[model samples]
Target: MRESYSLLPITELKGVGARLAEELEQLGIATVDDLFAYFPYRYDNYELRDLTDVQDQEQVTILGKVQSEPLLNYYGKKKSRLTVRVLSGRYLITVILFNRPYLKRSLKLEDTVTVTGKWDRNRATLTSSDFHIGQPDQNAQWAPVYPVKSGVSVKKLRVLISQAFTQFPNRIKENLPKELLTSYKLIGREQAIRTIHFPDGQANLHQARRRLVYEEFLIYQLKMQAYKRMKRSSSDGIRIPLDQKRIREFVGLLPFSMTHAQNRVIDEILKDMASSSPMNRLLQGDVGSGKTIVAAIALYAAVSAGYQGALMAPTEILAEQHAENLHNLFQPFSISVGLLTGSVRGKKRRELLENLSNGKVHILIGTHALIQPEVVFQNLGLVVTDEQHRFGVGQRGALRLKGKEPDVLYMTATPIPRTLALSVFGDMDVSTIDELPGGRKQIKTYWVQENIIDRVIQFMKKELDQGRQAYVICPLIEESEQLDVQNALDVHAQLSQALPGYTVALMHGKLTPEEKDEVMNSFKKRDDQVLVSTTVVEVGVNVPNASLMIIYDADRFGLSQLHQLRGRVGRGNAQSYCILLSDAKSETSREKMRMMTETTDGFKLSAYDLKLRGPGDFFGKKQSGLPSFKLADIVHDYRTLATARDDAARLVQSPQFWQEDRYEQLRKPLIESGLTQTLHLD
Candidate 1:
């Protein structure tokens, strides 16, 4: 039978059998292509070294003769050791392998072998546990380190990978044009793959990385360009011609005057509404920047023009919050409003659908459930999405499809850097709400040590005694039973004991949705004097009466998260405070914590975070399902990404490239990588 590329089991390879194939499959290596893309996380260099040149603490491979038989020693109930002596003519050194008496039988006195490991020096004597004895010139030079699981060793995986690479067919097509390679001074694909696996030198590795990084970013830029072109060509809903009088009247009725930044963004959105094409825009602002009010004005414009509008939030609580806020704001204007979410069921949901279909609901607010097939709109004109980063591009597209080519306004509270915004959201027009609403007080933030817990509690009690509310945030829901930090349940217990007179309520993810809602509702009504909870309350549970927020283990959270938590307080007329508690002693950790104390500006905090911890660490691995780039450091390589974006725009503008066969191979890898999904193309 002819061997198939995928149908043949992995055991068909030289050293693999059914059992080994199953083991390889457990590592997500089922086919040749999967193995090829599974790049090493890091490499260990094992270049040969002479015995005379072996230095302490340096990882080296040296060949020496065993001068004495290994000796075994046992000192404690659980401790055992094996000691071997190695000699190189005039010099001698003792090699100690701890807790492995079997090594005494594995090696003979006169045996000559090569050992690979790092040499350690203690009181002028060198020692190392990171050593492995092997035959000279047979072991790997630059060993690839894979993330090992149970029953797997780095050495064993290295052997398997080396064998796989040898037997695997070189089927990768050259996707980058030769001209671009020459212009960018990038290595070829074949060279990059080989050098990345077994680099001859640091310079070669760097060159390989540069080529790969550029390719990754280049594809991303290409997709953005395609999306931009596609959006420009798509048909738009009827433009709601701007009515300055109506807008001004709405602005006059607002409780506070619009900030200069808010007015600018409003003007930008108005211009988009009056344009010939649908608006694909993003409204980025810090927490409490009044983006909702601006969205309301846009919705009013759409409704006044005899069209409908919709707003989508990431969570049901946030969606409900938006609906309530909009309903209250539009109440005086007599504008109809409706709310729909997954939790809304039975007759209410059916009635909402009927109202939305009949255009009785001028503005609609809901979670992703609003995009369901049953929910349809009459002449939907504008779509606004809150916390846009929380939803994927596909989800946004699904929501947009609810309307007839409706204008889109995506909003994010997390302030993305200008460079990153350009790279990530390049296809969309960007507007930032850089100003806070008038009369809004800046939150006073402080970092405290654990020893100040009593003082903090006393302050909270004082606030509660004054008829104000407070929120105490814990990192975990239940007591971990193992970890030393406070949890929601434990904090609730302690606080209940500490403040016997105040009513304390606890909420966490472990609670059922109904239970969570009950707790949140009780806290919102100020029925509970103190609310102790986990990060479940992080996004959209607003309690204007809550004047203080105390977050334990504040060092465990990212800067953006810290800012979001701080935003939970300082929403009402009260002078609010946020206390961050941490036990960290490192200066870096202190400085990171201090960023919150120094500023309440989300953008400024993000900038500081980007500097302190690079973008990769800020979001962490598997952050929101963003594509992980093997080569590009989004923080450090901003200039390169910008250049790539510009180049992609220019290249895509050439109709010949999009129409010609020349770019087919160039676009194939991008499609295969699943990065093109963001572009809304097949």
Candidate 2:
């Protein structure tokens, strides 16, 4: 009989009724498959904790008798409390529950129950809000802690998980190849799944985690190999031969000469453009490295050859900024330019779309809207996506499919470490613009304590008096009553009050799109002397006159993010400064802050970040769209990854392996597990 893995409704499960099904849906468990695939974030081992030899302040589980009924006590206006005495025959411990009077009735006196909680050293007690009254065997020896949502308790979820595992079809397929499993000494899939959820010991859990991590990495390598194969086999649509005369003319139009690094990168791109194979290259540079000018030169060359070119940015503000810069640069050459973004209204958008389709607009710039179904290019020869890491392979594929296999150039201001770049962008060629443009002043960075706020404000006021603008960035948008970090609103209020004579405007994500645009526009025009905002201004919005950037709670942000925020300033000729305010006094924070002072090179900073925080922290799922693995640290296990990559390459090279039934069995589960989704293989 063939095994069936249908997406049955969660309500079909025994314990999941209508209300509980909705709750499970909130946790993203809509089907049996989803529940099965929902891996734990981490595991806890209660098997090592014993009632007889439990130490104070140690996390332990104890099976004891509730010698006394729970009692509720209230002290003045404080929250209500419940206390119960339990005896394990070896010792006695008081269990305190805060503001939970109902727990008193739930556990009656003389009840034998198993309670798992962390012991308190100061009070010599075990106070736990997570404790439950249940049979000893009912509690998991090794528990899986999932990423939980509101209204869901870990104990209840554990019960539901056990029930699900028992009812799971026992004929689950083993996806890993027999040779590979034997080589890695990994356990069978069925046993690994069971052990991962409820392991008998720590060794089994570790083995299960290692197998899963290896599987995740293996699938990732395979998908990347497939993408590479596809790219190699595709036909090149258009090849724009590089012309020195045209390049010289474009360079002559620029007021400042190109940096040697910029020139070299452009030369590399030109060579790719001239080749018969389509270009799949990444152009990485630091902020103010003059990447945009180099891209414009390439686009101009493509347009000069009677073809269309498009540039896609992650944000609408960036797209608009690109359009404005390109319009000014290409106006003398009479190269028609147009902007397409979500903000473009009815008739104007329709007209732009028509112009783009008919080749009336030689170059187009926009956000994700540029990849819409209606948008088309008459003869697109090249496509450049800025901030390439911010986009996924699937989105890039959608843009590339717009034209007849146009050459692609991905750009990013945040430099990626060499190892990470090789792993992430293995299929594509890469170029780096290592130098900043001439006449651009270096941004002097500083790390200051909160006590130096007055001095920073004084410096900002001095800059405002000099007809220059400033940016004060906060980590949060609104004032949270609980968080200790200073929010944009609070900072705006404080700055506005401190500098009453100067113009100060506040901007945050909570504001409407139009409202955000209005504030940004005002800031650009220098009507606002000081713009206090969140990280929304991290990219795209440019003010050449803004010379001061003050980042509050800068230690909370990653190194790459902080670099981008600092890039917002130093676009002008006047000397610029980036002040990083942090309360952290730890060695890690000090080292990170020191990086800002050492150099403005984003590539170096990224490499440092990777070493400090590891690859998982460098490119989180929110930004890179890659699956977070269990055992593979992209930094630590780089050698293993290389071995896997080579092994995958060798496997694909054998024609007989591709046709093998075993290969299908190995590949199918990987596709179903979402690793293929990362590489857009399906």
Candidate 3:
């Protein structure tokens, strides 16, 4: 019976015809089981309350008697107003509803009813959102509100869900082991599925939600654990011999001193290098925090041990930057460094590939070109990916496969919150470089409206006149009708006209790699005093002489991105400045600007950004490898996530747990959720 119902189509349900079925399919509900799994985003608390106790604009439910008949009046086209007067205690409250004229029948005179909505204090009215003909029981006070589309209304979905419950009882099978259920004090899967929709009582709803959320997090953590296990097993962990004296010599050769944070992270990385298990670590540091030096140290260690090392970047310019910096750093030791990018073609590319394959290139750096089929490595021991979030898992995985159990280091300049890191990069151990190097002055940041442009230009001219360069970043390369923000071309033209004496150049993502490199080279050499570009220079175009950054439409970007752009400056000895230009009316946008002015802490800004824009949008959702759980939220349910991670680690260690009869139900869902491709579930 359960199997039959699980396969039952939406059309088989009474009153669900073709159009409604199409709408249901839009919500990813095709079969009965899918509908059962579709949980509500939130619930309306229609618990009974007093009219006098309601605050202004507060959603409250009042049990009252209808003092007057509901008057239905037509307003604009397809719009109707239904008004009624309800008597509760000694107060007569006007109940206003919109476009729900059919509800007039339920608001008859002298009838006791329950109304739920926002209370408008000025109008002395209760704008009713939902109502019941009679006072519902305590268990029925909470109403489920599912995420709906244009054609599928919440009321209709509720009816269909209720019908599904009645038609498909006992269809939900218990997937969790009895030990887990007892240990967590969780309800059964069948009860959870049933109560999550109708919600019999508050206690039952809490228990049901807990069970479902735990299951979602547990399964996600299990997938992460499985991937971690696959990563360890696929590579024969070759422990790199760590010579502390050689490493100290390399560090001593550097011109500058390393921060305590850098030293700590390097210690962690070296420890991982010496371990038999492959090093799967994420190196997260703020912009200009000297992540490159740490990566250079790790590469030095790998190469000194008679093995090749490769570093991958997201963009050609960033790749070139790494190659240039590493070339200068490794020159003392005579360690060969090679560059491979989209533009390095024909003879040069072939020669580079040959050197790479023959182990002549001790340290190789490039964009995605490094992961191509032909770029073979003779002894690829270490793999480093700069700005790792920009590359997808498959790209990184492909590069790792080129070597025999290479130690992999994923580096990101964008600071991620620790909890977010655990959820997204849970497969890898995380190391953070929290402190900036000594004597690096903080960039003075300011937010200004677009109206104060002349003053900002004067300040820019003063800074440029003193032999400093400036970076002007726009959100768009070309003019966008949909967005009111300034484009690169317009900003370039404006800046050129304003600063006629200074050499102003333009760069954007639309430009070719050679063109971008040419423009960047000009800027680096101080030939261009002002460089107008898009977010292309947000990553790794380092120019120490440039000290001023003016960002237009700063509110259009996330806080982390704005920080990254700001980081382009303040890399030199002199003090730097960043001016944010926005005429944003929203408080959220204004708050972002204010926060940027408040502190230079990237981790704090990232945590706030994670809350403002969820984990999916923090980085690109498709490439993040973070799961889209229906009931579990990684931010709010982090404790639950941690517990689930521990449980998953324990469960995965049990050999062939997927094949055991006790976990048969669990394994079916894991495969169905698309873990079979990554995990050896068989």
Best by TM-score: 3
TM-score against truth, every candidate: 0.79, 0.71, 0.85
Q: Rate residue 79 of model 3 by lDDT.
A: 100
Cα RMSD to the true fold for all candidates: 5.7, 6.8, 4.4
* Each model's lDDT: 0.78, 0.80, 0.87
Clashing residue pairs found in predicted model 2: none
Compared with the true structure, the alpha-carbon lDDT of candidate 3 equals 0.87
Looking at model 2, which ten-residue stretch has the lowest summed lDDT? 673-682
Q: In candidate 1, what are the lDDT values of residues 19-39, reduced to their tens digit?
A: 766777788777655555556
- Cα lDDT of model 2 overall? 0.80
Displacement of the residue 19 alpha carbon in candidate 1, Å = 11
Clashes of each: 1, 0, 0
Error of 2 at 552 (Å): 4.1
By lDDT, is 1 or 3 better?
A: 3
lDDT for each residue of candidate 3 in 1-682, tens digit (9 for 90 to 100)? 0111137788888888998898899999998888889899998887777767878999998888898888999988989999899887777989999999888776668899888889987787988888777876686677899999969988888888888878877677888898899999898898888889988668988888889989998887787777787666555686999888999998997889999999999999999899878999999999878888999999999999998999999999899989998998899898999999999999999999998899898999999999899999999889999999999989999999898889999999888776668778988888999998888898999999999999999999999989999999999999888989899999888888999889999998888889998999998988899999989998967899989999999999999999999999998899999999999789999999999999999998988888899888988888888778899888778788888988988887775565566776766655655555434432
| Cα-lDDT of candidate 1 | 0.78
Model 1 worst lDDT run, 10 consecutive residues: 1-10
Best by lDDT: 3
